[model samples]
Target: MVFKCQEDSFLKEFTSKVVTCTEGQLKTVIGGKITTLSCYEVVLEDTIFFPEGGGQPCDHGLMDNVAVLHVTRRGTEAVHFVESALPVGKLVKQKIDWERRLDHMQQHSGQHLITALADIYFSYPTTSWWLGEGESYVEFDIRSVKPLNLDKLEDLVNEKIRAATPVFVTVYEEGDTELRKVRTRGLPDDHKGAVRIVTIEGVESNMCCGTHVTNLSQLQTIKLLRMEKGKKNKMNLYFLVGGRVLQQLSACLHREHQLTALLKNGPADHVELVDKLQKSLKCANKNLQAVLREIAVREAACIKQQVPIPRYYSLHRKEADSDFMSILINEVGDESVLLFLTVGDDKGGHMVLYGEPATVAQLGPQVCALLNGKGAAKGPKFQAKISNLANRVKAEELIKQYVTCTTSGC
Candidate 1:
C-alpha cells in the first residue's frame, strides 16, 4: 500500500481513518535482557509517520493523542503499534514529530548525494548505511579510501547543497520508457505497481523509497568526519549533516575552551601540552609506587613480629588492589595465620584469604557464601569480590570459626 508520506514528505499532521486494529507483542532487548510488551496494532488508511525501512528509523508521534511506540511495515502494510487500540472506521488525527522527520529527511538526502558522488568519482559503491542519532555513516565497497578524495567529495556535496538544486520524485510504470537510464538497487521479487525515482537535478537519479528534502539546500551542509576500515575490507565513512553539524561544532568549541583554560595553553597547543603532562604524571606515578612498595614491606614485617599470634589478621586498605594485596601477603608469609584482608572502599570490597591449605580450602567457599561473593582459590590463597560489604563482619566470623576448628580440632 502506498502511504501519503510517500507523496509529500513535509506533511506534519493528517486525519486518517483506522482501517484495522489488532493485539500483538513488541519485543525489545535492553542491556542483554529480552522484554516483551503488549501493544495494539492500529492500521490507518493513510499516515504521515514513516515506518522503519531503508536503513532509516521509524517516525515517532501521536495517534489520536495515544503515544505511537513503534511503526513497522509488513509486506505492503504499515502497522502502527500503540498501548491502546483505536476504534476501526473512526477518523483519527495523526501527528508526526516534525523535528525528527526533518532530521531523517536531511540525513537521508545527504546520504544519497554523498553515495552518488562517491560512486561517480571513485567508482566506489555504497554497500550499507546507518542513520544514528546526530551522526550517520555509509560503507563503501572499497579496501581503503584516500583522504584527499574524500575532502574533494565533501566540497562537491556542499557545492550542490549551496546551489539549492531542485530534487524531484517521479513515478514510472513497470517496463516504462523513462525507466531506461534510471539507476536502481533493484526491486523486491514481489514488488508491484509503479516504481519511484528520486533525482537531484543533473547530479543523480536513483530509485529510493525513503523521504528526502525537496531541495539540496535544505541539507544545510555535509561534513565528512572520518573514514575507517569495515568488514570484508570495506571502508566506512562517518559524517554529520544539517543541524547536527552545527550542534557538533558547538560542542567541540566548548570542549576546546574548557581544555585551554585547564591546561593554561592555546587550543592549538592542547595536544602537545597534554602529552607532556601525561608523561610527567607517568614518571611521578612510577616513583610513588616504588615508595608504596617499601612502606608495604615494612608494614608486613611489623605485622609478622606480633609476639602473640592473632587468631585472624584482618586489614582494610582503601586503595589496595589484587596485586598489592598479593605483595603484602607474600612479605608476611605465615601459612598458619588466617588473613582476612579487604581491599577497595565502602562502595564494595575485595576479600583475600591466606592460611593453611586445610583451613583455606574449606574457608574459601564458606567466606564466599557468607559474603555472597564469587572468586577462586590457588593453594592456601583465596581471592573474591564482595558485592555486599555489610556481610564483611559475618565473613570474618566464618573465617574465625574455620580457623578455630582446624587449629584446635573443635
Candidate 2:
C-alpha cells in the first residue's frame, strides 16, 4: 500500500477516520531524564505521517490537536502513537511536522544523489547509510578515500543539486521485470506493498522506502564533511545537507570567535599561539619538578637531624608527586623512624608508609582501611592509593598511637 504520505510528500493536512485505537506505552528521554508515557496506538484509514523505515526516523505530528509521539509500520499498517485516544470511527484532522519533514526530505534526496555519483564516478557502491540526528553518511565498499577523489565527488554532488535535477518515485507491482534492475539491498520479509524506485532523472534509480523531495533543488546544498574508517573494510563519507550545513557553519563560527578571544589572536594564528603556550607550560612544569625534589631532600634532612629522631613522622603535600616521595625516602635512609607520606588533593592521592618491617606489616592494613585505600607491604615499605584523603588525619593518628605503644611497651 502506497500511503498518502508517499503519494504526496508535501502534504501537511488530511482528514482520516480512525480504524483502531489501542492503549500503549512510550518511553522517551527529555533533558537527560527517561520518561514513560501512556499513549494510544491508532491506525487511520489514510495518513500523512511517515513511519520510521529506510534509515529515516518517523515523523511527529498532531491528530485532532493531540500530539503524535511516533509512527511505525507493522506489516502493512502505519501505526500512530498518540497522547490521547480517539473513537475508532471518529474523523480526525492530521497535520505534519513540516520542518522535520523538510529536513528529512533534503537529507534523503541528497543521499541518493551522492550515492549515485559515487558509484558512477568512483565505482564505490554504498553498502550502507546512516541518517543521524545531526549528520548523515554513506558507507562505501572501500577501505579509504583519496582527498582529490573526495573533493571531486563533493563538487559533482553539489553541481547536480544546483542543476535542480528532477526526482520522482516509480512504483512497480511485485514481480515487475524493471524492479530487478533497480538498486536495492533487499526488501523486508514483512513488506506488503508495491516496490518504490526513487530516480534522479539522468542520474540513477534506487529502491527506497523513505520520503524524499520531488527535486534536487530542494536540497539547497550538500557539504561532504569528511571520510572516516568504517568497520569491515569500508569507509563512511559524512555529510550535512540543507539546513544542517547552515547550522554547522554557525556553530563553527561561534567557536572560532571564542577561540579568538581566549588566545588574543585571530583565527589564522590560533594554532601557532596554542603550540607556543603548550611549550611554555612544559618548561614550567620541568622547573617545578626540580624545586619539589629539592624541598623533599630538605624535609628528609630535618627529620634526620632531630635530637632523638622522632619514632614516627607524617607529612602530606597536596601538590607533590611520586618522584618527590622517592627523593625523600632515599635521603632519609633510616629504618628506625617510621615515615607516613601522602601526595594528592583533598579528593584522593598516593600514600606511602616506610618503617621497620614488622611495624609496617601491622599498621599498613589498618591505615589503608581507615583512609579507604589499598596497598601491599613489601619488606619495610608499604605503598597505596588513597581515595578518601579527608580521612588522612585519622590514619595518621592511628599510626602515632601504634608507634607510641610500641616505643613505651604499653
Candidate 3:
C-alpha cells in the first residue's frame, strides 16, 4: 500500500480495508473499529479539513455524510473531529461544500480592500478583523469622523479592484513580519508558528487568519453597509461583498413590493398613502368606541329593571364579561342580606348581608357553605354570584338562612 509507519504524524494514504481507530496522535486505520471520535481534536492520516488556525475558521466537510466540524493539529499530526461514527481503517473519500469555502475567501479579500482604502484615503488604521456571519469587517483604530471623501475614495478603490492586482499569502517567522514593514496585530505573544500575511500589489500588507481570494476580482464588489461609531478611537466599517449585495437588493425590492400592495399605492406614493391609511384606522377605532358606549348606556336601564328590589345587586351591562359583574358588585354593595345573579359564565354574581357587623359575621359561614361562594359580611351583607346549578336553589335559601341567623342572634 506504500504506507509509511509514523509515530505522531500523518502516515500514508491507502485504500484502507479496515481501521482499528483509537485515541491516537492521528486518525489511523488499524484493526476494524473506530474510537475517540467525539473529541474536538484528533490526528488523521489524510484530511483536507483545515484546522482553525490564526483567525480563520476551521474547515468543515463530510466523509460518507459524517460531518467533520473542527480540526486541530498537534505537532505535525492532524486530527479529524467528526460528528458521527465511522468504520475504522476504511478508505473514505472527502467532499467539501465549495460555496461556503469560496464565500469566506470573498469576504476575507473584501476586508483587505476596505482596510487598505481606509489607510490610503482616510488615514485610518484598522485595529481588528472579525470574520463572522460568513462576512468580515475592518475595525478602524479611530471611531470618530467629521466627514469622509467618499466619492474620491470610492473611485480610487474601484480602480484598484479593476486593476486585478496579484495577491500573495505566505508565512513569516518572528521579527521578519516587522522587518518587512507589513502591518500585524491580535497575535498572541506565545504563538511560535508561522505568521500568515496577505500582500496586495502596491496596496495592503497585513496579517489575517481568514481565507482570502487569490485575485482582486474574486472579491467582486464591496458595498459599505455602514460605519458605526464606538468607544474612543474605534469605528466599525460594516460591509457586504459579492452575492451578499444581491441578497440585500433582493430583500429591499421584496419589502418595497409588499409595502406597495399593502398601501394600494405606487412606490413613490407609498409613504403618503400609508399615513392616510393610519389616520383612517384611528378614526374607525374612535367610531367603534362611540358605538360601544351607546350600547352600554342602553343596557344599564334593562339591567336595573330586572332587579326585584332597590337592592345593590344590578347587572351593569347586557354583554358584560365577568369583569362587568365584579365592578358592579364592588361599587353598589352594602352590608345587607343580599344575593347577586348575573346569568353568564361567572363565579355566581356578588352577594351581601345587610345588618350589623356581628350579625353578618354569624351568617357569612352558612352562605359560603351553601352557595359555593366566599366572603365575610359586616351585617348580613355579603356579595357573590350563584354560577353553579348545584348551588342555584341554595342562593335564595342562603338569604333566608341568613335572615333567621341574624334575627335570632344577640
Candidate 4:
C-alpha cells in the first residue's frame, strides 16, 4: 500500500486509527549497548511514518504522545513499533520528527538528481546507494571515477538545484502503458500496489518508493566529497546534501581553530609546523635508542666482572624492549651463568632466560606459569611474553631457589 508519507512527503502531522496492536519485544542497540525493549506492533489505518526502505531509515515520532521506536513495511502494511499499546480502532494524532524528515527528503531528492545527471552526462548507472547516519554514497557500475569528472558533475547538480527545478511523483496502475517509459530496477516480489514514478522535470524519471522533496531547491546544495573503491569492480561516490554540507563546514572550521591554537600558527602554516614536529620527534627517538643500548652494555659488563661469577642474575627494565634484552644477552656472552632478563613495566612485557639446556627446559614452564606468560624453548634459551609482570618478583625468587637447591644437593 502507498503510505500517507509516500502520498505527501511534506506531511508532518496526521490522524489515523490504530488497526492492530500486538505485544512484542524489540532488540536494538543504544549508545553502543545492546538492549531489549518490550513494545507493541501497531498497524495504523494510514500513517505519516515512513517505513525503512530504499536505503533510507524509518521515521521516528510519537503516536498519541507515545514514542514510536521503529517502523517497518511488512508486505503492504506499515507496522509501527511503540513502547505502549494504543487502543485499536481509536483515532490518534501522529506527529513526525520534522527535522529528520526534512533531512531525509533533501538527501533522497539530491540522490535522484545526481543519479540522473551521471547517466545523462557520463553513461554511469547507479548500481546502489546508501543513506548513512552521517553521510551518504552512491555506488556506480564503473570501477573508478576521475576527480575531474566528479567536479564537473557536482557543478551540474548544484546548477539544477539553483534553477529550482520542479520534482513530482506519478502513479501507474498495473499494465499502464506509461509505466513502460519509467526507469526502474524492477519491483519487489511482494510489491502489491501502484508503481510510483518520481520525475525531475526535464531531467529524468525513475521508479522510487522513498520520500523526496517537491522541488530540487529544497536540497539547498549537494557536495560530492570523495570516491572510494567498492567490492566487485565498483566505485562509491560519497556526498553530503542540504544541512549536512553546513554541518561538515562548521566541524572543519572548529578543527582548524583547534589546530591553530595547538600549533601556535595560522591555518596556512599548520602543515609546515607539523612536519617540523615530526622530524624533531624522530631525532629524539633515535637518541633514546642509543642511550638504551649503552645502558644495556654497562649492565652486561657489570654482571660479567662480578667476583667468583654468580650462579644466576636477574634484571628488569621498565622502559626497555626486546632489542635491549638482546643487546644485554649478546654482551654478557656466557650461557653457563643463567640469565633472567625482562623488559617493560609492571603491566606486561617480554622475558628471556638463558642457561644450561636441561635447567632451562625444567624451569621455563614453571616461570611462565608463575608470571602468567607463554614461551617456547630453543636450545638453552627460553623466550616469553609476560602478561602479569606484577609476579616478576615471585618468578625471580623461584629461579634463585631452584639454583641454590641444585647447588647444595637438596
Candidate 5:
C-alpha cells in the first residue's frame, strides 16, 4: 500500500499505531565478527519511513526512542525492523532521519531532472541509475556521448536547476497513465492500480515511487562528472548532486593547496613542476648508482689483495642491494671464498651468499634457518630476507662452523 513518505517526502515525524510485531533475525557484523541479532519486525498502521526500493536506500530513524535498524517491504507492507518489540495496537511516535531523507530526495530528484533532460535533448534514454555514496550515475543505451552534446546538456541542466522549477507528484489512473504517455523507468509487471508520476516544471514526467524534493533549487547544484563506456557499449554518466558537489569542491581545493605547497609552485604549474622533479630524481639516481659501482669495485679489489684469502668473509652494511653484491663477487672472481652478507637496517635485511656451487647448495638452507628466514638457491648464489637482526651474528657463525675444504677451494 502507498505510505506517507510517497505522499509527502518532507514528512519528518508522524504518530502511528502498531499493527503487528513479529520476532526475526538481523544479521550484522561487528568487530569483524558476523552476528545474528534478534530483532522485531514492527508494521505500523501508516509510516513516513520509506522502504528500500526503486534504487534508493531505505530510511533509518527511531520509533518511540527505540532505534529502527532497517525498513523493508514484505509483500504489500512496509516492515520496520527494530531491536525490541512493542505492543501491537500501541500508538507510538515515528521519526524519520531528516538529513538522510532530504539528501536522498535531492539526489533522486536531481536524477529525474538530468535523466529527463538527456532524453529530451539528446534522445538518450536512461537505462538504469545508481545513487552512490558521494556521487550517482545513470546509464544510457547509447554507445558514446559526444563532447558537444555533453557540453550542451550540462549547460541546459544547470540552467533548469538555476531556474528553481517546481516539482510535484501525481497519482494517475490506469487509463490516464496511457493517455499521458508518460515515460517510466520500467514499470513492474506485478504493479497494479494507480501510477504515481513525478513531474518537473517544463521538463519531464516519470513514474517513480522514490522520495524527491519539492523544487529544483533544493538540489543546489548538479555537476556531470564524466561519461565512460559501460557494459554492452552503454554510456555511463557520473554526476554529483547538492552537498556532495560542495564536499567534492572542498576536497579538491584542499588537495590543490597541498600540491601547490609540495611542488613549490602555483596550481597552474603543478604538472610541469612534478615532471621536472621526476626527471631530476631519475638523473640523480643514475649518478649515485655509478658512484656505488666504483666503490664496490674498489672494496672487492682490497679483499682480493689480502695476503691469505679468508675461509669465510661476512659483511654487514645498511641499504646495499643485489647489484652491489653481484659486482663485488664478480670483482673477486673466486670460486673459493664463501661470502655471507647482510644488507639493510635493524628493522629487516636481505642476506646473500656467494661461493662454489657445492658450497652454496649445502649451506643455503642452513644459513636461512639460522636467520629465521626462508629462501631458495641456484648454483653458487643464494638470497633470503632475514626476519631477525639479532640472529645475524649467529647466522654468520653457522657459516664459519659449516665451512669445509671439500665444498670450496679454501
Candidate 6:
C-alpha cells in the first residue's frame, strides 16, 4: 500500500510531521480542502510521504515512530498510511529508511553513469532499465558490448562519486527552454509552463524527475554482476553498488572457504577445483547409467518369459524401485495383458494395466484419488505410494478389477 516516490527526490535521514490521514478504502491523504488539493501527490500539500512512480519503490520508515505501511496517493496528494493510526490536523514527525534509500540512490545514479558511458564509449543508447529486486539493470540498443569494460566504467563512476559533485535541477517556462527541446519520445503532451531537468556539474545532464544522490560521492562504487545480449540490437547489464556489493563479496568468500576445505586447494585455485569437481561428477554419472542399462536388459528378459495374463501380473519384492517394474512391463510388450504390479517396503512402484491411452486416462486419476496422493501416467504406467507390503496383494486385485471392469471407471 506504499505510493512511494511522490515527494521531493531526496532520501536523507530527514523527518517531517504528518498533516493529515485518511480512514476510508483507498485511505488517501488529503491536506487542504478537497477543492484546492490536486487530488494526488503534491508537495504543496506538505505531506511527508513520497509518491510511487517510475518503477522505483516508495520511501519507507517511521511516522511518529510507528511503522509506515503504505504511502499512497490520491490524485497529486500523497499520504502516509501507517500501522498506528494518526489524528488529522495533528503533526507527526517521519524519518526515511536510509539503508534502503541509499541502495536505491546508488542503483539510480549507477544507471545514469552506465547509460552515459554507453553513449560515450560504445555509442549506444539505453532502451530502458528495469530495476530489479536487490539488483538493477539497464538495457541498451548496442548489439555487442564486448570486453564489457566493467572496470573502466567503475573507475569513471567512482571518480564522479568521489568528486562530491552537486546535482542541480531547473524548471523551464514554456517559451524559454533549450534542454527540454530535445526529446526521446518527443515533448510531453501536457506541455505546461515548465519542464524539469537534472544536471551533474562536469559529467552529464538529462531530463529526469527520479530521486538521486545529492552528492555523487554517496554512490561509492558500481559492481557489474553480469551482462548479456537481450535481443536484436539490445543488451542487458546487471549490477550492484556500495553495501550490496560488500554483502555479495562476503557470501562468495564463505563459499570459497567451503570449497577449499573439501578440495584442499588455495583460494586462487577455486576455478580449477570447480572444473575438476564437474569432470568427476560427469564420469560418475556415466558409470551409473551404464550399470542401470545392463540391469534393465537382464530384468526385462526375466519378466518377458512370464505368462500372458490380461489385466493382471505382479512381481513383489521388499526392495526395488520403479526401474525394475518399468523395464519388465515394457519388455513384456503392448499387445498382451496389462495389469503388472510390484511390491516393496524400502522401494515403491507400480506398472501398466491395459496400458492403452484410454485405460490409463480412466485408471490413473481414479487410483490417485483412492491413494490420496499423486503419480505419473507414462505410456500407461501408474505408481502409488502404499504404507506397507500388505497392500501388494490388495493392489494386485484392485488393478485386475480396475483394468477389466469398464463400469468401475478406475
The model with the greatest TM-score is 1
Give lDDT tens digits, candidate 6, residues 165-266.
Answer: 776666665455577443233344533434455567766776654567667777776788778879786889888877788888899889888988988989
lDDT (Cα atoms) of all candidates against the true structure: 0.86, 0.92, 0.58, 0.92, 0.85, 0.61
Q: Between prediction 3 and prediction 6, which has the larger lDDT?
A: 6
Instruction: Tell me how candidate 1 scores on lDDT.
Output: 0.86
Count of clashing residue pairs in every prediction: 0, 0, 41, 0, 0, 22
For candidate 2, give the lDDT of residue 396: 84
Model 3 misplaced stretches (Cα beyond 4 Å): 1-41, 45-47, 53-55, 72-79, 85-92, 134-136, 146-155, 177-180, 231-233, 278-410
Give the alpha carbon lDDT tens digit for every residue of 1-410 in model 1: 55788789999999999999999999866677998889999999888888887888999999889988889877677899888989999999999999999999999999999999999988989988999986899999999888899989999999999999899899888788778887776776656777788899988898877888999999999999999989998999999889889989999999999999899989989999999999999999788677767767877887878888666787777766676677878998888778878777667778888888777777788887777789988899888987776778888777777667866989
RMSD to true structure for each model, in Å: 2.5, 3.7, 11.2, 3.3, 4.5, 7.1
For TM-score, candidate 4 versus 6, the one ahead is 4
lDDT by residue (341-396, candidate 4, tens digit) is 88887678989998899999999988988888989999888999988988888999
| TM-score of each candidate structure, all chains considered together | 0.90, 0.84, 0.59, 0.86, 0.78, 0.74
Model 6: ten consecutive residues of lowest lDDT: 35-44
Runs off by more than 4 Å, candidate 6? 1-20, 23-44, 72-75, 83-85, 148-151, 162-164, 171-178, 181-195, 306-327, 334-362, 370-397, 400-410
Better of 4 and 6 by lDDT: 4
Error of 5 at 394 (Å): 6.5
Name model 4 segments beyond 4 Å from true: 30-37, 307-318, 329-410
| lDDT (Cα, tens digit) per residue for candidate 3, span 331-388 | 4343442434334344344444444466556655665567566565543455544345
Local error of candidate 5 at 290, Å? 5.0
